[model samples]
Target: KPSIAGKLDNIQGDIWSKGFPKYYETYYFFSIKTPLLNEKNLFSQCLKNLSTQSPRLISTLRMVREDHNRISTRRKEEAIKQGIPEKRVVLPEIPMSNALIAFTIKGLQAIQAGLQDDTSLRLTDVAATDPAFFAGMTPKEVTALLKDPDQDTWDPLFRSTEIHGMLKIGGSSKGKVEEHLKNIKGVLKHGTAIDDVFQDSPSTPTDSRVDGWTRPNDRGKEHFGFEDGISQPLMNGIDEQEPGTNANTDVNMYTDPRLLIVTGDTKRESSIPRPPWMENGSFLVFRKLEQNVKAFEDLTEQWEKKGCESKEHMGAKLMGRWKSGAPLAVVNFYTEDSKDPDKAKEMNNFIYENEVCPVSAHIRKTNLREDLTENDKDPRALRTKIIRNGIPYGTDYKGNENNTKLTRGLLFACYQAHIEDGFQNMQVNWSNDSTFRTGHPGQDPIIGQVAQKSRGVNGDLETFFNDKFGVRQSVKFQQLVTMKGGEYFFVPSIPAMSDDLGM
Candidate 1:
């Protein structure tokens, strides 16, 4: 038997055990050219070309080891130079460049069929079992199921074009990422035996390219001026402690590895057996959400006028956390994020039993902690756990709340074993459901969408500011975050890509 680290080396993309150093990233969505000449052998040859370039692809285990080596090397150099022990030396995190690739249902079908002659070839037997994966993201039924906006409002590439696959390249800077992307395109074009097999459409205005990056100067904060990615679930085998924090003591924050990976021993409510080809693979959900900064600020201002304590309080209630990454469940008033490292580590060590965080708050709705019965809490947590790996895109707001010209928001992405029980369940059953557990806590004020409505409805968005005073305030508002476009993809393990697809 191989170790978990060795197995992870065969899995492409970040596993969220340790977050990737992605300061900047470029997402390239392209379609495989139809009517492929010699389609039988052409597709396999193309995959072989990609497999030969595997050395350029970063695996989850390689990322962890490289990050560890970088830190250790820095500590050793500092110890020698300063005449101190290595344990005493501390350094800031260093960023690294990486690349990953994933295929949509259509792409996988095309590869499996080997020829474009058969339109009936389906991946239902050999691929993922989730119906959401088989039914692409833009279908009318899927839109209604997920409470998404009309397809007409989405980017043309995602709404109409048939996206076969995506190539993601990330680095410490924009220039480095761009250079790497150039190299990847070159390899795909010339190295492959087939020419023009995978090409971006020329008719599209956006060129099927989306650029993303962390907010400059203020790292770890989203365009909404709030700390993001603070309360991620800690995997059992891949991680011993939560990054940016000390050892995770909260039982609710830890997750079993079986919940994330596809193995023969994996068991779910569904009867479908795990495919051998997808042993270590995971389902990927990609969404391009555009945030309206000025509109959110304007709404906060309106709430302040309507008996709310303050704009910061209203924002905190909506998100379940202060802008400084401090959870409202643990703290009272909003203040500057603590500069002390010890205080920052304690931020993610609380549950929602205190009622300080609203039931309708974005985080609370997404991850319910101890809000249900003892028996239900643990089971529900296991069902909805997802590893979020996303970043901010576009520039920060420039003071004008009404400027529609400047577009900025999150390029949200998450990985999970089962799509139906994970992201979809969180969106449809939790976030969008007003009467989720106890109170009529309305929709998630930030990203939750109402059926057939262009905006969100927070019917009972309420929170208790002062527990002693018994003062509870509620406010209603429309959603600020809008889903521009998205898709569901299956990222294969490196071995599967090389042996199965490349064959």
Candidate 2:
């Protein structure tokens, strides 16, 4: 048999650390599959629980193909230039595990409606708390109402409207949004809807329970205000999705070996034991991060006059990318050449020499090849590579200026082999590491904090602009890059969900 490395290409794209391109919704979590006599029967039933509005595998393939078209054209061109048949550039054909599922309140409503024949059980309470019952209602006002513990405001969103369906590329639409999404011109016609890529949900009994899910205004932007999700890790054998790789190599540029293997799969000289379910599963962190839009805007304005230039430059410098998702690490100050296709190869082809692109920038800090040097003494950064899986939750212009409303932030979910070594340590240590800050050994400018009493946006945006000033002089990161949210969950592999007493 071929080595596991050879079988690497056989693994699906979505299961890897970076994640697949699709929308997702998180349903209420169920206990690990229980080991019982009825369990085998439930396994089949559980599989039925997993449903999607779109053909999972097909939608995934379309996304992968689109990505291939963008990243592979250059390699095809290169092969042509080298006097070689472009067809020789063998690209890997891989399937992506569909991480998204959909089971709306309407779906549940149908089930409940079917069960209405039973007069003893009242469906009233179930209908009342379900968000699907009120599909088009004001989610904000409804959210406030729902928080009142006594109010039952979730009824209407669950009552399925034809428009509230998932828009498919081929099949007939299912919901209200699905129907409109299909006819929305450039939006949902081609392959999948943009929102679908970022908003798909797991099929569970609780989806219809949502008051209404909203996308944050600053969602596409990271903590530093740059558009994110531009560069993702491509599995080595799977296919190259990131910018640079050509044919043989370029088609596989995003595959970073550090993230390929699960924690316990490989032998370690240090002898750290990988957790029990570490191999096939991933750990996710769902944080309700709240951003101070007004404060962030003001800081950008102040930094601009001090030579940071436009919002785009400051955004790129701080986030290592522009709104277009171009990384400052790869192309500093947004050069036309970087976008010229010729120079836009490796996303990591960055020159860290200049302070123009701050070392404390979110992208650089999160992916510091330097800080991750000691994987043995502390596999902190290396082990912290969890797949970020949640979407921006909240509304547009809800709390943009003032109004005291905490409008938006990420439902920050990250999947990892080990939670302790991954998300937990990264947030508590690296992201909060003052020493990791580029110049002043200051707090990580993005997610770091100053004392609670002295907390607010850093007053001196200029001092922290470049690494010129000292750490003490740097402004404290007052923005909440992430915030509190609901329960923690462990997503299981299909097998795990069906075996071992739903542990």
Candidate 3:
């Protein structure tokens, strides 16, 4: 038997890889709408294509190993030139094209029913034990549970169509990703037709695909000008072996491997027994969030006019971090992010205390970070942990206050073993709940929703404009990040694809 880490190729790489080479990506959603006579044949052909291409899927373990070797070689070369041992080397950015495939519950049932010899068998016979996976993202009940806006407000493609599965294609450049997508489309052309395509930073008029990319030169920042993808949970087997040890070793940042991987030894005693096919599989939560930058800026300007705080300070208080990725709880001020490498590494180390970072701050609301003492005995933190692999969609706001035509936000995707306890719990139980920790801290200023008219008071956040000024005030923020559309998917292991799905 091999260690889980050794079987890297078995799992979908996007679930583990920080964010796939992410210069550009195309999330191709497809439906199995072939005629009954050709349904099985079409499904099999699509599965076969995926199985054959499984080897090309980027594996995080393999990626880490390759990066480690590359860094070591680079360090040796630098050391030789300097005539001394190299202490540090700037990490090289990997440029590569990759693809990941995941399916909705209906898609899995369709595939199983199409391929399985026994036509009498049902999805329950081979279910993964997650009720949410079966219920999906569009149901009125699920929408209400997630506290998302009305389904009617969502994009027609997501609200009306049955999205069976998605093929995520990403690479070093738009051209490279497009080339990869073309080849993929060509391969699956005989058996399948893409129902719709969602692109990152879509260029043309006909391309209705949502656009996303790392900001040019300013890689990690989103359209809101806030640094993103920081403070990720460090998994036991994966992050420990990765090149960077300084930040990964922090116990506060550590997350149980089972939270993101399907394993028998989960901390939840009441957890349902999962099928063998779900061994390395993980649940993927995909949300297309559209940000209203103009409205947010207008609100910030109004706050700045109050004379209690500057726009920069107010923004950091809301997000719990500066634009440079420095946590307000750690750096205590926005101007403290002075391009120091050592200071940058210390960003995720601090714990929430005395509301140094407001209790309702986006980061604090999403991750309590030692705010609850029960974390030592039975950790709620572990249950809600999710590995985010999202990217900013659209372009820079260009200070256009009235431009509704240019949409920009995040293609928010996260991986976790349990959907109910992870993403759903964070959004519903924590983010939306005003009195989450202690006191009426209000909803998460960034992602939290009011959910109902009764909860309207919870929508306004109370925070100090400046702790030094002692000018505490309540600010009612409009819904800035809108949930346009989304879906839940199951990224199955390679073995599952081959043996169980009949690839």
Candidate 4:
């Protein structure tokens, strides 16, 4: 049997290569009903349902396709020149399903109950479990085999890495959406006309957004300041083999490489031949990264008075993008005349003759036009592709009277192959590394960590300055973004679930 990675047609949309748009997320877990969906056609029916998707997910699918095709084209050119046959070519493509997220404990239970009526469910008895495959693998190896190393392995997957907990779902009105989910749970409750495999239910009342869900803690304003999700590596036609490792910096190998290429030469060695359930399985990670509103406000205000009038422009400089997603590395601060200023202009188009915006600004730091010239970093941002899917978790911004300040921040979710190498390492080693840009002092300025050795105004945060050049620097982060709780989850392919592990 071919490995699941070779089968893109069977996996869930958000589970593997495909990612949902940035929004609040939720995870749903369900159990099979006793009578279960008719095994005679269970697998076929499930796959059919997967073909149908929510509207938002469909748009993201198109973007993923474009990226996949782009990467495929590049890889094909490279492979042809290298003498590889066209038939053996591998190009990465997005997975079909977007992994599901459930917001509360009740949400998890609700999903479990829904499984009772889920015709896609199958009985454990007659499912295609293979003893030889089981014998070839241990519990640990089986778990690893279930996850593709090349696919994005952040948030949703992080949540699954835990023994228990529910996924948080997002949308316009989170509280209202949560209630709808609870209502579904009631419909599926046991013996009241519908069947229940996981529980009798009705004992647990539905949960509401009013109760409020707490956010995660591991985020901060990258040194430059504007909320940053600025750059990410897009998928292309690259082999699944380990890309050459960088030697100059220390790399947390496990965390950095968390993405899986569903359409390319991406491959992983399963202890045994892949099963149907395991095909095209991708991991998804969701996190609620809260940004400090007060801190950002104060910081931007201080910088604005210093001859920079556009707060949005300052954000672009700090985030590498205008609120509209345009890169400041291209357009100037005052030139609002450009018809829709959101699209990023090409590098050759930008006039860098004048250093009105310092060359070492946040955008310039991460993507120095020359791939090999500045800091010798690869110019291609594909290595850092992370599908950011999150939302502003707290209430709308209010004035000073609201001291508690809406528990505001970004629901920072990213999808990458390795956590340590992708987001964590990027923050610590790349973006935060003050020494990355040669001859430039301080950090990336936007996401760079301001440490004891950090370049702050006055002697560190130790001394006070009166009207001095350093004293003019009034911007500093007061409220900060933090990560609270999350886990790594593996979205198993249908074959891996049914035949390999019998999940």
- Scored by lDDT, the top model is 1
Per residue, candidate 2 scores C-alpha lDDT tens digits across 49-112 of 3322234322232343444454457557768777665533433333222332222233223322
TM-score of 1: 0.85
List model 3 lDDT by residue over 132-217, tens digit each: 87889988898788778787778765774457877777666777777766666666662454344433334542233454777776
> Which runs in model 3 stand beyond 4 Å of their true positions?
1-3, 34-41, 54-95, 117-122, 125-128, 190-209, 241-255, 261-271, 338-342, 376-379, 452-467
Arrange candidates by lDDT, highest first: which order? 1, 3, 2, 4
- What does candidate 1's lDDT look like per residue over 1-503, in tens digits? 22255565676656554566668988877665443555444645555566567455434556645765676688799999988766446555465577777778887775666644443333664344667887878789999998888888886667744677777777777887877766666655533422222234745534667889988766778988887776666655555664435323333344455455333336566566655666777788899999988878987788678655578877887888787767777776655553222355457766677667777789888877554335454465456767788889999987854656789999988887778777898998888777775667777888777765645444322232332244665455555777888999887777777665434
Off by over 4 Å in 4: 1-8, 15-279, 306-312, 337-382, 444-480, 500-503
Model 2 — which ten-residue stretch has the worst lDDT? Answer: 165-174
Question: How many clashing pairs does model 2 include?
Answer: 50
TM-scores of all models? 0.85, 0.56, 0.84, 0.51
Give the local distance difference test score of model 4: 0.36
lDDT of each: 0.67, 0.39, 0.67, 0.36
Model 1 worst lDDT run, 10 consecutive residues: 459-468
User: Which of the two, 2 or 4, has more lDDT?
Assistant: 2
